[model samples]
Target: MLPPSVFESAFNSSPIGKYLLSPTPEALILAVNDAFLKACSRRREDLLGKSLFVAFPADPDDPASSTNEAELRASFARVLETGTPDLLPVQRYPIPLEGPDGTIAFEERFWSAYSAPVFGPDGAVTCISHTTKDVTEQIRSERALRESENRFRALTTAGQVVYRMNADWTELRELDGRGFLRDTDSPRSFWLQDYIPDDEQARVHAAVGEAIRTGRVFELEHRVRRIDGSDGWALSRAVPICDAHGRVVEWIGAASDITERKAAEEKLRESDRRKDEFLAMLAHELRNPIAPISAAAALLQRMQLDEALVRRTSQIIARQVGHMTALIDDLLDVSRVTRGLVELERVPLDLRDVLQDAVEQVAPLVQARRHTLALELPSQATIVVGDKKRLVQVVANLLNNAAKYTPEGGCLAVRAGAQDGGACVEVSDNGIGMAPELTGRVFDLFAQAERSADRSLGGLGLGLALVKSLVELHGGTVGCESAGLGQGSRFLACLPCLSGDTAPQGEQDDEPMAQAPAALRVLVVDDNVDAAVMLAMLLEASGHEVLVEHGARAALARAHEARPQVFLLDIGLPEMDGKELARRLRAEPATRDALLVAVTGYGQDSDREQIMAAGFDHHLVKPVDMERLEAILAGAA
Candidate 1:
């Protein structure tokens, strides 16, 4: 027989409530801690020896009962009758209990219960042990975990590959089978001894070992081999599990199979590097036009109004701005293409107009290089409806390509004539022609025929490829035909034509020069030897006598001999800057009457104000335009 003392001792100290039920299930003997009393809304004496059915009855008339009283009785009855354990799915039963307010509150509570039969020596059922646990939060957490896993799986599977690594780093089990990857590591190890590349294994091993030892999560990317014997890429991370004693037991981690992603990242990085190169090219290309445009703007600002000259200057501004916009747009367009989102604007435009505009754009280079350019156009108008800008780009690319490959004295011929139901434009140049192998890959992105560090040509290989893509976008095809090495090359563009109106005449007429300013002894000062020489040449061309000085100190010494009426000083001069030089020149009695102009590449409004405030009479930015410069000289005289 079980000792009564043992039951009493358990009754006093137990956390869960225990009750001795009477035959009628009315009043009951309560054995519980304060939590149980609170759960049932009762005291010890009120629950003692009362029939269990009467004291804690299911509401006879109410459909909703307090504690699964009927279910509990049924479970208890089964345990008593059969002495067997009954398993149940999780169920919720309200406590039929309330706080001091008699209202349902946070602790008004529900319990998920389990009952077992405790047997005596004769195998008769002695008492039932009932256990209740609050599972509200646990259930919620489990559901959230499942939903989150589903969501994470969805995102990773859509584009990037996701994998789950086992506790040991030995296996990289696939989570998704996208099969899009770039494998750089050897593919023979089933992704172990050879999955990570030789150069990367040491680093991978270190990170993984550190993570496991410290029980910390680990993350990294490494070259991995794929199943196909081709190398690829993978990014992985791991989480550690700890025992109750705070010792690490196991780890669960996720990996993303990133073969294509790796390739794309490498490509993007290359693109960024190319953009940096382009910006450098742009800086150089920009200088070519900026000197003239800014000079023109400054000259236009000061000159008296005449419609013809004003129109000419305005056209110059529009053209230069358009060039800058086009270059910037090239960068944007490449970005769009790589991101898989390039749109086309289709419109009917005369192919002749595009060719003419492109020719005119390169006219300055033609004259500068002393190259003879011949244009052959069909008398019959050639009309092709497509994107006008892209058409212009195609023609301009041909011209640029010609200029780069041809010698200074080479001939560049542009022809635009009607072909078999299509418009054809061809550009041919003579210089050092392409080698057969080079010609085959001329249109490859970033392809360069000559990439020796000291090669003379300067291009990133985007121009022709961009031209090709743009032309193709407009329903046109472009091709290049070149004789072997030393033989010149010709680019042919063919666009399907629609019988339409004649092409408009682009601006091909030249504006009359701004007449020469009265001659004056001028002094030009700059630290950059090339810039000062170029300025002096331009000034001399404008009919002014010019003297050069390398620095502010040199300018001060040369001022006495030059007896100059005007001085152009560079702001970024070595030792002393233009501002100080201008001030020092003004202090000299001989130069007091001389007009001081600060010439520099700094065009910010604030930079101008600072120069003007520092005793310079005028500020000029570099790449000086001849007309504006002439006006500056005229105003000073």
Candidate 2:
């Protein structure tokens, strides 16, 4: 038996827990700290210095008891020889035994068992020092905490936004796909690995140096790595997270996907530039008609009363005004087509009927030029789903082109029938045919075929292009063909046919359009004298009492004299545009009740809204028409 002081020394050296030991031959003896022994039903005097098999006893017949007895004896002998402890698989178990008071008191305990050999002063094996550590709840808690951390890490790394950073941007630490603490060969890394070109690496390195110097943010946009492994533009912003002493610690950043936004902005800018070019071309085009119309109107306005000459010059002014209106309408159509904002009113339209109306409208022009128009439309209806008014415009443009391009006595043929399982229409003219190269670009905006040097060809190239857009919008296509220059040109249109052919009544069934009251006193104002008079003349012929002014000051002077019911003012003037002039006019009681109308080439929808808000009641695009003018005057609103 060990002395009390020696036992105290061993107990103090060891933590407060249960322990196990084996005697030299074969015996199960356990040593426990006072803290552990207090929970036992066995008396302290009985526990110490007693045979451990008596203190904490087990059944000799049980498998656990016999197996543990053999293992303890074997391990003790081996530790004595080798001077090392041995671990056992069974970490926890209860030793069933008797207690003090000579009563059968059950002792229930959990422990981690350990066995090491003890030596005497002669260095001979005396016993195996053994221990049992009570740690039933601690191991379970650590395992649960480890599991929770692993799950959280997995969730974070799975997201695209989460990333690990190196103190320097030179290298990156990759995150697993699940964000867990495991790695694969293809882990998620930073964008620096790609995107930057080989030549541009030096530049980026210099930029990194600057960022490190000032500890400021690095802002840049460049083509960078994408998740798909392809390259795209990235808007990257990185900022240095500094230490307490103001030294740079680490840099962190976010890269946003800006590829689509950049592309869309470029497209919008291109569209705006095209519009500016078109407007400039429009101004140049309007000058052509304004000059001739102004010259003719000025000559007629100065003439005295000769009924024959008066009538003849009036016809010239009228013809020129019509030509100008056609051109202006074409420009408006181009804007509408380019923006993809044209809405179609789908009514069942018969192609033959539309072609006939177009043919009749061009009959007078064809007659004067002595060009023969041949019609080859099928008698039956060639049904289509379309807007009737737009269809009329399309056919009118084709027929007009046929008549205008064909020389006097040349044949212009129109054929509408079924072809290629769809409704096909062909317009052919025996005129100076176009070159192959010209045919390719014929439908481009502002494109025109060069005629003889006199340059008398009237139409802009906007019509065919507009028609092509309109046709495609309705799921149709159009193309032009020619047998080389000077032979002829043929234009064919193929439109999808309507479902089952029971059609509605023709447009003659809806002919009675609105008719307002008679024309009111209307004022026409412009910077150009001829434009103002010709507009005035057009309205006058349409049955309104018309007044004309050359400029804004003159217009303000005449506003009271005319007591106009409506003012058609141009926006471009020397002193001010018609919009500002209209504001001043609206302030005057003389023209207070009069409806102000703006007539300018700046006819974009947004521009029109601006003029209207500036006190104008109506807006008209430049180059007037007699019929539309009559409609406006009659309504006078």
Put down candidate 2 lDDT per residue, 1-637, tens digits, no spaces: 8788997777846655554455545354445566556445344434666666565556544557655556655666678779887665544344664432233533334455667767779887667776656655455445554553344322222222223444566544443334322343443454544546566567666776787677788876565544445555545567777779987766765544455445766877966765566565566667786787677768776847588877787677677777777886777778777666466778788888878888888889889999988999887888888877777777777777777777788999999888877888889999988888778766767555233223366566687888788788778888899988889899987898864465944664432233554868777788788777767776676577887777888888888776888888888888877778989998998887788878888776657767888998777776543445556566654
Off by over 4 Å in 1: 1-215, 226-232, 244-249, 258-264, 275-379, 384-397, 407-422, 428-452, 458-637
Worst 10 residues of 1 by lDDT: 181-190
Cα misplacement distance, residue 188 of candidate 2 (Å): 47
Error of 1 at 336 (Å): 18
User: Which lDDT values do the candidates have, in the order given?
Assistant: 0.68, 0.68
Please give the clash total of every predicted structure, in order.
20, 6
TM-score of each candidate structure, all chains considered together: 0.39, 0.46
